[model samples]
Target: MTRRTFLRNVGLATVAHVVGCTKVIPELAALTANSVNSNTESKSGKNKLPKWKGFNIPDYFQPDPWYEIKHTPEEYFKWVADWGFDFIRMPVAYPTYLNISPKKQFISAEDVYKIDENKVEQIEKTIYLAQKYNLHVSLNLHRAPGYCVSTGYNEPYNLWNDKSAQDAFCHHWSFWAKRFKNISTGKISFDLVNEPCYRENINDTKSKTTAVPGTLYHNVAKAATEAIRKENRNFYVIAEANNGYAAPELADLNIGQSCRGYYPYEISHYKAPWVYPDPAYQPTPLWPGNMGGRYYDRAAMEEYYKPWLNLVKQGVGVHCGECGCWKQTPHDVFLAWFGDVLDILTGNGIGFALWELKGDFGMLNSNRSDVQYENWYGHKLDKKLLKLLQSK
Candidate 1:
């Protein structure tokens, strides 16, 4: 979900309900498509990850159950496999599957461990379906026990400092690791958290959100990694980079790292309602134009990625877990900027997953005004964008 949608759905939890397509595959066929294998530790001593390309499945992204848990249709999976994409990152909201209080208030320390098996089964079904299509699933907790980058719901405790929250956070990861322990690491991996950043007040939407200290971030991630390993040592674990778009700090551990592609916020989030709160501040984006008081272009992009590139040189596995422009940007500008983004990432042997597959920033039904879309299987396909992504 985009920042706009998350903020809009913050207080609608009471009325939220499950809604989505009910299309189901009658039979679970044997895996016909080739799933990418997990790479071993590199000579640099960091675990290596496959340079997989695909899209994010926001099934459980919204924490308040605001959107459908499984919005992507089965046919979309077939299309992803047919298009040569090999990855699907599912951002899960823990609240959607937890047995929260009837009032649905902030989960207290005593109430955080209750498990709702039925909702969890729904998650498992979706993962297996994606796997059936030969797509490696990266299960991520977009909303964890005590923190979420999106300031929609109020978490009971601060994950960075509260021991209670940290325990609960580790509990959730352990639950998932045990739940899918039987699955092969090649078919699925666990992303510990999504887009973690430092927020003095997590419930205050207007407060400053900055990067957490490297040591604190490392401690939380290391604890969570140990939690997952205790349940199943073979479970491949990934810790999203601190502050989402920055370089990862957990190179001492065997877990992989995930990064973001939404650099130069002016381009990726141009005029996005949640981003540009004041319309007068939203500048018309240009590929090589001056943005945020600097000349922005491919050279600037290369400079931006220098830290990530340096991390890869040290033998750490890295992937762009979320990258794409909001549909508000002009189509031509989006393509030009995104083309460079893809080129730089792929040229460095890194892979990326577009923020979504169907809505807003996606390959189908993006609702952008400037693109001439092609009709494919009754869905409007962004052929130009697709060609660009497929080429990478």
Candidate 2:
């Protein structure tokens, strides 16, 4: 469909354009205007803005090519700050930080694995950017190598079943705590794992229930967190359960005062072909009942997300760290969802980093250029959606 026709159906939406130092973020401006319906400061003076509405920057928009060499953090973050994002979520793969087989023969590896000198340097770079921009930065371990959202390695990672691997993971955390401990000027934090998925579904041959692995994964997180705190007294640390999304009822109450947990929901992944029928067709155009009203929206905050939001109010500081409906979920649905997300996050005390700055389903398309952002299957970013987060 032509971009004009698609947008006409939605009425007020536009892609964010970076025009040098300033950005023509028309999409966000529109979302702020329409998505939020309530008054910010009450005439009588009672309402307040909650903290969970913040956005993220991680593997999706790192300054350097994640798979290869180093890059400039200052130049990259300068662009990030231009986008009006309040925080940066940097997802670093631990293996990239260190070599696979540095000194020990613990695991059978034909090659070598040593920590890259540039990796931590880049981390320090991120810390500097965060401090300079007044942006909160959460350092997350995106790939633990042996475990992740899906099976990428041949070893059949069972982080719950393997005690040795778990210990190895803990040791890595200890090292990180010691090295980057000073990076935390209170704005920097350590996120335990990017998306700790521990399920038999990785095999496809095994029938898996969601409940089993999450429990074990949380226990492992608890252990790793304890190990980190042993060294750094007040540095902030975030732990995520097996699935990316969080459940207030399931959280371990013993989490440290300075530590919080995050949850990852596929508000952007609904009916998304990535999780649906054929992995080839990406769901777009905001089909009638497609995501219907889910649009990864704000209304969900009142009903579906209350459990998680309550935790943040209780001081858990729950973070979605990752959230965004398909760039083309459907205008009405997108507006509803985006508005709800803003209200709920701002209403409570949660902090969230959008799944990306730009990409397949990001706020911006890859190459940092402006193409129509999809609100549904084929729909592009509309002004209405962008305005949601910007709303008072």
Reference-based TM-score of each model? 0.87, 0.66
lDDT of 1 by residue, 1-392 (tens): 35433222222111112211122113222222331212343456332678889999988778653444545678888899999999999998788887764347466666678879988888888888899999999999988887776745778877775777877888888789888887887788889888776556766656665556666776677778777766566666788876544545677666678877877778888778776668577778889788768788999899988878877777677888889998988888888999999999888888899988898888899989888999989989999999999999
Poorest 10 consecutive residues by lDDT, candidate 2: 1-10
Clashes of 2: 47
Top candidate by TM-score: 1
Give residue 163's lDDT in candidate 1 (0 to 100). Answer: 73
Top candidate when judged by lDDT against the true structure = 1
Q: For residue 32, what is the lDDT in candidate 1?
A: 24
Q: Write out the backbone clash pairs for model 1.
A: none
Candidate 1 Cα outliers beyond 4 Å, as residue runs: 1-47, 65-70, 101-105
Worst 10 residues of 1 by lDDT: 12-21
